[model samples]
Target: MQKSITNQNQENIKGIIFMVSAVLILPFSDSIAKWLSSSYTTIQIAWLRFLIQAIILIILSFSLKYKITGFHKKFILVSIYISSSIVFLFWGLKYLPLANNIALFFIEPLVLTLLSVLILKEKLQKNHIIAVIIGLIGTLIIIRPNWSAYGMASIFPIVSAIFYALYLITLRQVSTKTNSKSLQFYIGVISTILLSVIIVVCELLNIDSFGFKQIDFNDWWLILLLGVITTIVQLLVSKAFFYSKASSLASFQYLEIISASILGWLIFKHIPDMLTIIGAIIVISSGLYLISHERKNSKT
Candidate 1:
């Protein structure tokens, strides 16, 4: 049992690393999609992204011998989660700056904490409350809310975050009985099917046109990279929750903000202003403390 616990910890650590790396890669993918967003509709970009993800997920599931069936009851909730996530995220990418969009996503952990306390009856530790406060302070720094600077684009990601939190809470409830890979696979598959239906209906109704911009061959590499890397990342994140509490792993998501700010500045020549930087630090620090606290409590 001791050895088993140690092994699980090691796996969780690896999952954390993969998840953080994936979070780092995500901003770049968003940048790419956002660049394409001007010419392409939101559903077009979403379908393309999910189609690629679905293909990669199928291959991985088969190769790893992960079952993709069962868990019928969880499908509706999972579908709602992924569909809402894809649409809102793509739409947010369309209108908001990359850094701003990502910073708002940080709220997801706080949302998860609230859900756990309310729905799951999980008590928040002292550190959990402190972390949340610190994280919120960090968010305020990033948004620096002013009467003059608000826009509808900012609200989309917040809605996305809320939907994502609900998704996480539902996953936490179901994860103990079902396999993590299966959960990830079902999400990808469901999202793919839903997207396909939406694409066909849109085509029929002439609601919007999908522009298949003949790619420059080289860009196809990035698209493939985006698909494969994201699939692997999703699998790793799913597995992470197997060993750690969803609420525990959820807080570490704040690390993505630091990664996004650095990447956004380095690749896009976009720098977060002083307030954003201060907020990022507060969120990151509090989130780290929350994770550590959870780990310590779990051991005791």
Candidate 2:
């Protein structure tokens, strides 16, 4: 019994470490995307990001001797949702501050809770309801809908969060049946194809923001780093989730917000306003409480 408890504790520690590493690494990719957004269209960036990821993942799969499997609807759906989330996030980053974008995206956990209740038919506790409300309030504070300069761009991250939440939900179902590398490879391939289609459509329609442009040498390096780092982060996060309960993993996600804030300050000299800061605190607190509450209920 003691040995079993010790192994469980070790797994929990490993999960926390992996999760923290993933969140830290993820901000770097977003920062690079924000930097590159000035030069490349969102669709173009998304296309390259997924394309490179797919290539690397294919190589990794072959090296590791993991056979590519048949088509699964869940994998395709997860890809679509994640691809949409990335496109929306990069679009928002083009206009919004990194901190603002991260703050808005932080509502994903709350969104996931609601999704669980609705789609998973999970019973919602009173604390979960309260946490969702508080989380929304925090997002609103950061957005400040009427006053923010970004205007409609502010809504993009919220949309990104929604898609990401759905991705997480879909991932939960698919992760059990698929190997992580194969799953990632398939999603990368599907997303690359989807972004390619979007880019072709945008070019045909002459949509300036979505139109493709020739990549420069500097941008090539950045895009490569974006894909590689993002792939690593995804693997780390997948391992983290495998080792820990979703509820326990939820709180550590806020680390991305902190890392984003630092990156924004260093790279862009952007700072959150008083209201945004207050909202972040509230959101973090509420999310932590929600996770702890869930953990307690599970224990009982």
Q: lDDT for every model?
A: 0.71, 0.79
lDDT of 1 by residue, 1-300 (tens): 877776666655655565556565666667776676776777767666767877776787789877676866776687678678767876887777777887776778889888988887876666666777687778878877653554777777888889888887777677776776667767777777887787787777777654233455666776676566566666666666555555556667777787678877886677888778888878778767865754664464
TM-score per candidate: 0.85, 0.84
Instruction: Give the runs in model 1 whose Cα sits over 4 Å from its true position.
Output: 1-22, 69-71, 209-218, 294-300
Note the residue pairs that clash in candidate 1. Answer: 138-279
Q: Across residues 1-300, which tens digit of lDDT does each residue of candidate 2 receive? A: 767766766676677678779987898999999999999988888888889888998998789887876667888899999999999999999988898888778778777866766775656667756766776677678666664577788788889989988887777677767777778888899999898888889899999888899889867788899999999988787777666545455556665766787789899999777887887787677657755654554344
What C-alpha RMSD separates each model from the true structure?
3.2, 3.4
